[model samples]
Target: MALGSLGLVAGALLIAASSRWLPGELPSYPPAQNAAEARPAASLAIHDARPGQPARRIAEDLIAPPPLDVAGVERIEPRPPLGELGLASPPQTPMPQDWRETLLYRPVATSSAIFEAMGRRVVISGTIDVDPDRTCAFGDAVWPCGQRARAAFNAWLRGRALKCVLPPDVDRFGVAAPCMLGKQDVGAWLVGNGWAMASPSGIYGKAEAAARGAEMGIFGPPQ
Candidate 1:
C-alpha cells in the first residue's frame, strides 16, 4: 500500500484502541441468559417491574370514608309521557267573538298582526317600525334588535291570555280597526317598549317619547 494509506490506517487503529473497541464493534450490553431479564433498561427505569401493568392503576384506597347507605335509597319510577311540565305552551292568537262586530288578530311573528274584520281579511296597518335585523352597539359588542324584541314578546304572550278592544269600523284596505290591550294601545305598547318607532303621522307620539326617554326595545340607548 502507499505510505499515505498506511499512515491513515495507523491513525484509525490508534483511536479504536484508545476507546477499547478495536477488532469487532460488539453489542452495547451482554445478552440476557433468560427471557425474564430481556426487557430494555429504559422500560425498567420508567415503569414498575410488573410487565403490562398501567402506571395509573391504583390497587387500594389511600383514605377510607364511612360507608354510604345505598341499600335504603329510594328507587326511581318510570317517567310519564305527559312531557316537560316546566315548559310553557305556545300562544293561540285571539279570535274575534263576532266576525261582523269584532276584529280577529293573529300576530305575524312581529309587530304587525293579521286582521279579519268587516268581512275582510288583511294585515293590520303597522304604525310602527321595528328594526329586528338592525345591529347596534351594545356594551362591547353589537347585537340584533329584532331577535330580542321577538323573543321578549313571545315569552310574555305565551301561556297568558290577551284581551283587546277593536273599533267597529274597517280601514281602506279592508284591515280591521285599531285594537288595544286594556288601556295600553297595541301600537303605543310596541313603540313605548322600544321595539317600534312612531309612525310618520306621529300616531304614537307619547309612546315613542316614553320609549326613547327610557331607552327601551331595539334601540340601543346612547352610551
Candidate 2:
C-alpha cells in the first residue's frame, strides 16, 4: 500500500510539469468566403434615362439632311485657256548633235510652197504669199506662183538629202527656226529663185530684188 501511493504521486507531478512546458493552442480564423463575395468592385458610369418618344424625336433632330444633288457624282473637268494654272508654256527641246547626221532626207513634198522633209514642215522662213493662190507677175501675164516654186525647189534638191539646222525651237507647224543645206541657206534660196517674197519684215529684200532682176521661177520672162 505505501508503494502504490508513491506511484500515484509520481504520475500527478508529470501531468503538472507537462501543462507548464507545452505550447498553447493556435489563434483561430473565420470560415472561408464564397466566390461571389470575393470578387472586386467595378467603377460606376453615369446615365440619364428618358421618359418617352420625345427622346427619339430629339435624336432625329440631330440627323443631317441629304445633299443638293443626290443622283450626280462630283467631277473635275479641264477647261481651255490653261493660264489659270499659273505656269508659262513649256519650251521645246534642243536638237542633239547626232540629229544633224541622220536627216534621212527624202525629196520634200510640197503643198502650195510649204515643203515637208525629215518630218518637218518647212516654208521659206518669213516668206509671204507663197501658198498656191499667190501670183507671179511674168512679163504681161500672171500665173500661179506656188507651182513654179515647187518645180524650182525639186530641181534644186535633185533627189539628195540636204543637211539642215533645225531651230533651237520649233514653230506651230514644227518648222525649225532656221535651217540650212550645205553652205546655202534654204530660205534664201527660195527668195533668190523668185519662189517666195520677202515679208514685211524685209529681211531678204536683196534676194527678192536679185530674183526679180533675173526673172527666174516666179519672176517670169519678159512679156
Candidate 3:
C-alpha cells in the first residue's frame, strides 16, 4: 500500500537505535559512613589511676618528690678522715736499687779496706787515714772517727766473703784499723799500693794517682 507504509517506518527506526546503545542496570550503592569522631579526646592523661598496683608507688605519691633539703650539696671533704689531714705518712717507697741492704760494721779508722766480689763489686784498699800532718787529714777528718770509718767502709762494701768484719780502731798511725780484704778497694789498693794518697775526695783519686805514680807504689820516684 505505500510499500506497506514504508515497511512500518523502517521497523520503528531499528527499535530506537537499539535502546540507545545497550547498557543500563547499575543503581543500588549506599553503605560506607565512619567519619570518625564519636567523642574521642585522650592524648595522654591517665596519671596512674591505680589499676594493678606499682607504677612507681603511684608515680611517687602522685607526681614529684625528690629534693628534701639536700642541704647545699657540694661535699668532697671525706678523704681527710682516713688519716686525718696529715697525708704525708704514705710516701716511703724507696728501697729498690737491687735491694741488697745490710751495712753496719763500724771500725775503719781509715787506710780503707774492702774486697767482696762476685757481683756488687768492692775492692777498695788501705792506708788512707790521711795525715799529711793532720789538721784533719782524714780519720774521715774526725768525729766518731769519721762516722766509724764510714760505717766500717760501708759494711765491707755490703756483705759476702764471710761477711767482711773488722772494726777495732787504732789509727793515729797504729794501723790495726784498716782491714777488709774480702770486699776490695782497700783505699783503691792504698792508692794502687804506693801506700795511699788518692783522697781528693776519691773516685779512685786520679786513677789511683796515675797507677801509683806509674808503679813507684807509694808515691815515690815518679817526680
Query: After superposition on all CA atoms, how large is the RMSD of candidate 2?
Result: 17.3
Q: Which lDDT tens digits does candidate 3 get at residues 16-70?
A: 9777765654443664444443335443334554678754323444366665777
Candidate 3 deviant stretches above 4 angstroms = 1-43, 49-71, 78-149, 158-223
Question: What C-alpha lDDT does candidate 2 achieve relative to the native structure?
Answer: 0.61
lDDT, candidate 2, 123-158, per-residue tens: 555565466656666667777767666767777776
Best by TM-score: 2
What candidate 1 gets wrong by more than 4 Å, as runs, is 1-108, 111-126, 159-177, 221-223
Native-referenced Cα lDDT, model 3: 0.42
Please report how far candidate 3 places residue 122 from its true position, in Å: 15
- Give the C-alpha miss distance for residue 36 in model 3, angstroms: 13
Q: lDDT for every model?
A: 0.54, 0.61, 0.42
Candidate order (TM-score): 2, 1, 3
* lDDT sort, best first: 2, 1, 3
